[model samples]
Target: MRLALVLAGRYPDLRGSQVLVQQLADGIRGRGHAVHLVTYGAVASGRPGPRAGRIVRDLGLVVRLWRTVRREAIDLIHAHNYEAAIASLVVGRATGRPVVYHGHNALAEELPLYFRARRARGLAHRLGRLLDAHVPRRADFCIAVTEELGEILRRRGVAARDLTCIAPAAAPCDAAAHGPRVGSEALVCYAGNLDGYQNLGFLLRSFARVRARVPAARLVLVTHAAPGALRRAVGPGVEIVRAASYDEVRARLDAADVAVSPRAERYGFPMKLLNYMAAGKAIVASAGSAKGLRDGVTGRIVPDGDEVAFAAAVVELLSDAAARARLGTAARHAVEDPRAWDGVLDRIERVYRNVLAARSAASTDPEASAPDGLGVAAE
Candidate 1:
């Protein structure tokens, strides 16, 4: 099948959505399907750029996307996020192609982070909710990164049959191959953006408690954000490192003794958890974000925003080498299981085939006039 993957951001960016888009394109191509990516030419930052600039760029993207669909005779359109989905819906309608919307995160929870002003943020969030409630309904099918997110979609009027929950997966990384250890100090690493939803303040307070118990333990944060910003957030005693590539992040994770994700959000899955699991590192993550993780099996799962418990979990794993090794091994094994990318793609491929089959059938029927609207189809 020929597929067009669409995203409303710069290609090959450091963001998780970019990583997911790249993975999907590669996976689809590896399965012998042709895939073309459509994305904005401009770079996007933590904050949204000028509204006028965004509108112009999006217009250009849609034009390019429509041309690609027509020229390539694309059979399916798979769009990521709201903006891309809107564009795909428009193109799919024009080209008579089915669209699959891949929802990475709940916009209602994420939109506010883009605006600095409280009033603007509130307005953006309200608009986000409206999009969330309406956009997926336009797609032929929807993919949610977590079951919690699938539930949110259902609440927003998306039918269960139209939704598939496929968590993100990470390629396996060998932690032992990355040269000698950087330092003897036991390193606890957090590899992601310092977004407000990440609960870094709680992480800092918890890490401070961990420092009290294990004075030699060090916190290493690997992100694209400025080191000064992280230093200000966590205060003194934390080391910040910026890694440009995934290879660098894996190397740093290889050097670390423990990985932490203190995200307080419940709607979406953290892509970093997959990296941590792939690195075979003992993880200390919040219960809400660590969806598939078992409390004492794959990794330690603490209640959200519980700094003392979160700190204790990290310190305990850091102190016990045997337990850390056991959990880390289990975490790696979990990712290597059938739920990994190979299996994930298997399910996604089925969705694509089903959508294609339904469309083919609908075209042959005299009464059928494009399979419009959103809802689940029988598996």
Candidate 2:
């Protein structure tokens, strides 16, 4: 099958979206499918100027898809997010092709001010609703990342039959030891975007409290958010670093005795939870972060927003080496029971095969002419 992997960012950045896209595209192409990428470099951070702001982002991708689809013989377009979904919807409509929309979040609900669904007003503090309103029910298939998010789509009138819940996969952490040795003080890491919604302040406050009990404790903040603000607010007993190189990230993860994922979002599973688990590090995470773990069996879970519970959980885990090691062992092996990347793409390939076979068998003619600038076959 010929597949076009689409995203709204740069190709090889040190970000999750870019990393996931590059790996997914390579996997699909390696598995005997012709894979091509259609992206808007403007939105990607370090590529060039003029990032794809609200309205023009998806439209830009649509323009790129229009120029590449037929020329590359793209049989399926797997768009990564809403902006990319709009691109797939437009180009597929003009070319009479099918598209699989990867639902990274419940757009109208999670980023409400940003989506067009009229009921989405005040849902989020962003602006993207106008386009969401113009292009509703645009994809042939919608892939939801979590069950909570899937229900949001159904509530909004999306057909349950057209939906598939494919939880995002995390690469194993066995290979996370190729960087500099971590610090000596009991190292704890919280790595992610520096956005305000991340609630780093809460984590920092808890870390300060944890320091009173464990004086040698080191709280590592790996992010691109306001390091200056973080440095000012961190007080003592904290190490604020902007961002680490890819290898450095893994090294830091491996070096840390405990990793924390403090997520405040109600929707979208914490993908970082998987990374911490993969690294085999003891986790003293938010009650929300604990949702990804199996309680004491995997890692410790603390109540959300409760500094006492959060700090105590970290301190208790740090004091008990045997228990922490037990939990870490289980955490590291949690995902091994499931498929890794190669296994994940194998399942995806099956989905693509079935979609193609059904589309082909249903078509009456295989030799139908495609669009003037494109090609199409009626199935």
Candidate 3:
């Protein structure tokens, strides 16, 4: 099958969405399917320019996507994120191709974080709900990243028959990767972007309490994004370091004694949680972001927004080597399935086949194209 993977941001970037798309492309192609990328990187200047600049880039995406569909004869359009999915739907409508929306998170839940003022956030949320209700329903199929997100789509009116939840698989950490080996007695690491949704403010506060109890404890923010104002958010003992590549990210995780994810959003999967597990590092995560972890088995799960409990969990793990070893071993075992990637690809291919078959049947029967009864279940 030939596929066009559409993204609004830069391709091959360190962001989770881009990383997932790149991995899918590599794996799908390895399975003998062709995949092409459609992104604004060709026409846009920065990652995301100002308001006016963003409007222009989005329009450019529509034009470029249409051209790519015709030029490559793409059999399917698999779009990631809101803007790219909208653009793909437009092109798919005109080209008579099937489109699949790969939902990373609920727009209503995430959009409000971009605005600082209460009124602006409320307005953004209303607009996000409108989009959420209207957009995914128009696609041929929808793939949600988490069960929580799938439920959100169902509430937003995406038919159960046309939606499925497929979580992203974590790539194993490379032992040979190069990164800093800090000398802190106990190191706590968080790796990802500095976006508002990361809930770094909560992390900083919790780390401050941890520092009070254990002065030897240090928190490191490892990311590919520029720290900018985030450096000011860091109190003493917390530092942000820029990671150049995934190898460096893995290396940093390897050197850390404890890995942490403070994200409290319940609708999306935190990729870093999987990374920490793959690295065999004892983890402390909020209940919302702890996807595959069991309370005392895989990793420590704390209630969201409880700084004291979060701090205590980190301090406990740092002081108890046996507990850390046991939890870390369990966490590593959870993601050690060698066939996980193949299973993901197989599921995605099934969706592609189902969508294509439904479209074909609709072309002949006319009344068979309704999306209300076309979907595969999340296994």
Candidate 2 stretches with Cα past 4 Å from truth are 42-57, 112-136, 172-183, 224-232, 337-343, 361-379
Cα deviation at 33, candidate 3, in Å, is: 0.5
The digit string of per-residue lDDT tens for model 1 on 344-372 reads 78878888887887788787885764354
Tens-place lDDT digits, model 3, residues 1-379:
8899999886557777777888888888888988988887734224221256777777889999999889989899999878999999999999999999999989898888877899989988998899899999899899999999999999999988889999877643221223444455788999998887888999999999999999988888998777877887799888888887887787778888899999999888888887788778899999999998999999999999999999999999999989988998898788877577678888999889889988888999998755533577535
Q: Which pairs clash inside model 2?
A: 114-127, 114-128, 114-129, 115-129, 116-129, 194-225, 362-379, 363-379, 370-375, 370-376
- Show pairs that collide, candidate 3: none
Can you rank all candidates by lDDT, best first?
Answer: 3, 1, 2
Off by over 4 Å in 3: 42-50, 172-184, 369-373
Give the total clashing residue pairs for model 3: 0
lDDT of 3 at 10: 67
Clashes of each: 2, 10, 0
Estimate, for each residue in 68-143, the C-alpha lDDT of model 2 and write its tens digit.
8889878988888777887788888899778877666555444542234565455443343443433335676566
TM-score of each: 0.89, 0.81, 0.94
